[model samples]
Target: MKDINYSEVNGYLFPNLKGREEVKVNSYFAQMKLKYLKTNEQGHLFSLMAKNELSTYLEQVEKEANEMYERLVEEFKVKWNVTEKLKERDQMEWVQQMNNIDNVVKEIILKELICN
Candidate 1:
């Protein structure tokens, strides 16, 4: 498979999936395949490039998921700081939220990076 480039923005990047902010990214790649990857003049999409590009796009999606998870952790910390001083119960809730985020990020990162 051909390698595709990944772009990052604001320390966050989304995958070039069918939907999401990367719609333009996906469309641009589709057009690239239609123009350059097609075997004929019929503007048909090229399977190889499409597959490679989609995989690269998915990598971006995974990156975004991880970043979102980190953001959630930060949010949880801020919320916990505010509530912890008032109620001890808030600390347990904060820990639970952190654990959840950690599990999600681990699964996604492993799938995107190590397993691949």
Candidate 2:
């Protein structure tokens, strides 16, 4: 199998918005979306078919949202780093941190998308 580097991913990387700030904002929005969706679905806000149809639609949305969220976070990791210095080799650490942040965002998006 061929190995794929981070830079090879589809889409342009963000030159800025590295570290915790970006992650935090994304996470917050994802959570909000999840909460809203859950409430709406539970309350039968759609007023369409039965619960089965509503649940199916919600599942599809959640799946797409999760995929997008994961891609965005991976891109962020590749673009942002603590330092470019070769000797220091801290960029990898930054990448790891970014991955952690991505997890939080993914969870929020999953929940929100399902609910909403």
Best lDDT goes to which candidate? 2
lDDT tens readout by residue for model 1, 1-116: 85555568789875553332232334322333333323453222234334445445445554565575577566656755535553466777766766765666556544554333
**Candidate 1 displacement at residue 55 in angstroms:** 1.6
Query: What does each candidate score in C-alpha RMSD?
Result: 17.4, 21.9
Q: Please, what is the whole-model Cα lDDT of each candidate in the order they appear?
A: 0.49, 0.52
Question: In model 1, what lDDT does residue 69 have?
Answer: 59
Report the Cα lDDT for residue 77, model 2: 52
- Each candidate's number of clashing pairs is 2, 4
Error of 1 at 42 (Å): 23
Worst 10 residues of 1 by lDDT: 20-29
Segments of candidate 2 deviating more than 4 angstroms: 1-35, 38-51, 82-92, 103-116
